[model samples]
Target: MATFAEPLRPNVASADVQLPGVRDYEQVDTEIIGTLKPTAGWFGALGVAIAMFLVGAAAWIYQIYWGLGNAGYAPPVMWGVYIITFVFWVGIGHAGTLISAILFLFRAGFRTTIYRCAEAMTVFAVMTAGLFPIIHIGRPWKFFWLIPYPNWRLIWPNFKSPLVWDVFAISTYLTVSSTFLYVGLIPDIAVLRDRETNPLRKRILAILSLGWRNSEPEWRHFMKMYLFLAAFSTPLVLSVHSVVSFDFAMALTPGWHATIFPPYFVAGAIFSGIGMVFTIIIPIRKFFKLQHYVTINHLDAAAKLALFTSMVVGCAYLIEFWVAWYSGVAAEQDYFWNRVFGEWWWAAWIMLTCNMIFPLSLFSQKLRRNPTWLFILSIFINIGMWFERFVIIVPSLSHEFEPWQWGHYVPSWVDMSILVGSFGWFFMWFLLFIKQLPVVAIAEVKEIVPPKLRSHARGHGLDPSGHHLPYGTETPGEFD
Candidate 1:
C-alpha cells in the first residue's frame, strides 16, 4: 500500500541497477500479485513434479518394504548415494539464508528482488534434506529416537556423532529461516488481503497476515523484527554448513579428516546454493514475465558471487592435494592419489570440471550477464557439487585401510529413483508456493523505486488513496 512506502531516497548506482519500471504503488501490486494467477503451464509443471514425487515415493516404499539391502550399499562403501545426497541437499540449503539474511545485513539492494525466492528455496531444500537421514537410517518411523527426550528406557543418541549435530543444526536453521521468511511475507500478504475480491481467499490471507493494517506502529515493529531476524540469521550462513562439514572433518577418514572442511564446505554450499537459485529463478523469470523485477543485473550480481565462491572452492581443491602430498603421510597421500586415479576416477573428474573449471567461464562478463549461459553453467555447478560429495564420501570409504577391504560402489535403481524423486519433492512444493503467494516482495521493491508526492500529502496526513502516509507531515522538498 502507499502507506507502506518509505520516504524518497537515492538508490546506489542508480544508473546501473534495473529498478522495476512501475511508476506507482498500485502498479507494483498489480504486476507482482498478478503472478499468483496460475495458467495451464503452471498446472502442467505441477503435474510433472507430482508424478516425479510419486515415483520416488514408490521407490521409498519398496525400499522400506524390502530393506536397505535394495540400495547400493556395498561392504566398504556403506555410505553410498543416500549420504552423498544428504550432504548435497544440506549444502543446497545454504544460499537462501546467505542471500536473504547475510546480504540484508550488508544492505545489498540487489538481494531485494531475489531473496524471497531464495528464502523459499532454503526452506524447501532443508525439508528435502531432512528426508535423507531418515531414509539412510533405513527406518523412518523411529527418527524420533534422535531427539533428546525423557524416554523411560533411558536410551540416548550419541552426541559425538556428526549426524546428531546435523539434526540440531538443520532443525534450528529451518525454524529460524522459515520464521524469518513468514515475517517478511506478512506485509506483502496484507497487501494481497486488501486487494482480494473473493471472501474465502481474503479470509485466509487476513489470518496469515495477522490483521496487519499497514499502520505506522506496525511498520515500525515490522522493520525492527526484520532487522533482528536478519542479524540472527546471518551467523547461520556460516555455521549450518560448517556443522555439516563436521560430518567429515571430525571423521578419521583420510579425505574427510581435514581442518579446512568447515570453510571449504561453507564456500561450496554457498556456490551450489546460488547455482540452484539461478536454475529455479531463471525459468520463473521467463515464464512469469518478471524480467523487470528479476533483471539481468540481479543475475549478474549472483553470477559474480558464484564465481567468487568457485574460486574459493578451486583453491580448496588444490589445497587438499597440497595437504595430502606435503604431510607425507602414506595413507593420506595414497587416498588422494586413488581419488583422482582410482575406480571412481570419472566421478572425480566430473567434480573437478563442474565445480571448479566450468564456473571459471563466469569471470567473463558476457557469460555472466547472459541468462541462457548462466542457466547452463548453473546446471553444471549443481552436477559438479553432487559429484563433489560423492567423491568425498564414497572414495574415502571404499578405498580405506586394507586393500582387501576396498570395494566398488554402484547405486542401484532404487537409490537412483529416490535421488530423482528428491528433486521432484522439492520442485512440487516450490511450484505450489509460487501460485499461492507473491514471489517478489512488494514492499521492498517499492523502497528502491524513487518516491513521489501525492495530493493527500499536501498538509493532509494521507495519500491519494486515503491511506495514512507516514511522512505526510513532511514537505515535498523533504522527500527530495
Candidate 2:
C-alpha cells in the first residue's frame, strides 16, 4: 500500500501569477484592503472610540494623580466597575480562544477565516481586560507587587490570595493568547509581505513573519508550531476562566461561594464571547464583502455555539437557584431570592431573557440563518451577558451579611465611562486589525473550498478559462 501525499495548490509565490481575467487577484486584493481601510463611518466610529478611551484614560490619570477615591469604589463597593469589566472582558475573550484553539484541534473547517479575527479579538480584548486590575488598585504604581519577585525590600505577593491567583492566571492567559494569535498570523503576514510593494510595509511584515520564505520546509514547521500552540491554548482557555471563577467561589459571600462557579463562569464567558464575535463579524462581513468566506453558514455555526452555551449558562442559573435552596443555608437562600425578587430583580430578569429567552429563538433555523436577526440577537446576548456579570458582581458585594454594608450600589459617570471606554478600546484594536491583517485567511479559504466549487463558474462560461472545462481546470494535477 502506497501512502498518498497531501494535495498541493499554489503557494504564496504562485498567488502573484494571474490567470488572465478568470480571477482578478488584484481586484480581490484591492477589495480586501478597501474593506479594511477606515471609511467615513469608520472614522466616525473611531472618533467615538477615541473619545471614550480618553475619558477612561483621564479617569485613570485622575485616579493616579489623586487616588482611587475618584472612582466611587468605597468600602462596600470596593470591587466596582474595575473587577466587573475585568470579568466581562475576560468573558468576552473566551469564545475566540475556544473557537480557534479547541475547534482547530477538532479540525473544525468552519474556523479557517473566523478563527483569525476571533483570535485577534481574544488578544486585544484580553489586553484591555488585564488593564482593569492595574487601574483597580488604589496604588496603581505598586501593581507589580502582585508578582512574587525577589526584592531587597523582602516583600512577596500573597500566594494564598485569590487576587494573586488572578494575577497569575490573567498574565498566563494573556501570554498564551498573544503567542497563539501571533503564531497563527505569521502565514498570513507572509502573504502580505510578499504582496507588499512599499519598503516599510515589506520590512515590517518580513520581521513579523520571522524571516519566513514560504518554503515547503517553512510551511511544514509553521504548521507544527501552530498545532502545538493551539494544543497549548486549549487548556489555558479552561484553566484561566476556571481560575477567574475561583475568585468568586473562594469568597465567603453567599451568592459568590459555589463549586459550580467554574463551569458556570466558563459557559457564560463562552456565551458572551460568541455574542461579541457575531457583533463584530456581522458588520465586517457585509462591509468587506466577505460573504463567500464569512457566509451565513459561519454565522449559523456560531449561532449554534451561542445557543448551546446559552443553554449551559441557563442550566447553571437554574442550578444555582436549586442549590441555594437545597443547601438549607439561610443566607444563601436569601441571597438567591434577593437576586430575583430583590431590588436587582430587573437585572436577573434581563439575564434570564437575554441568556435564555433571546437565544431560544435560534432554535428556528431561519432565525439563525438570517444575518440581520443574528446581529440583533448578538447585541441582546451581549447586553444580557453584561447584565449577568453586573448581577453577579454588584448585588453580592452590595448586599453582604452586615446590614450597614447592605446598601445599593450604582455606577457613577467614571464607572460608566470606563466600562463604555473598554468597549471603545476593544473596537479600536479590532478595527485596526481589520485594516492591517487579511481578515479572511486566503490560504485556508482556498484549502476548504472544494476543487470542484472553484471551477464551477468556468464550467458555466462565466470565468475566463475559455474552454468549458470541468472543475480544477487551471490547476488540474495540482489539486489532486
Q: RMSD for each model, in Å, please?
A: 7.1, 7.7
Pairs clashing within candidate 2: none
Candidate 1 TM-score, C-alpha based:
0.91
Best model number under lDDT: 1
- Candidate 1 global lDDT: 0.87
Q: Report lDDT per candidate.
A: 0.87, 0.79
The local distance difference test score of model 2 is 0.79
Model 2, 1-480: lDDT tens digits are: 999776333331222222222243344455555565668877787788888788887777777888767777666767888888899899999999998899888776567668878888899889999999888887877888889999998988888988898888899989989888777777778778887889998999999988767689987987898789889888889888899999899999988999999999999999999999998898988877777657555676678889899999999999999999999988888888999999899999999999999899988877977889999998998889888988998889877887776876767677777787788888888877787888776556545433333555545533354332333535421221
**What is the lDDT, from 0 to 100, of the residue 405 in candidate 2?**
68
Reference-based lDDT, residue 370, model 1: 89
The TM-score of predicted model 2 comes to: 0.88
The CA lDDT at 291 in model 1 is 85
TM-score of each: 0.91, 0.88
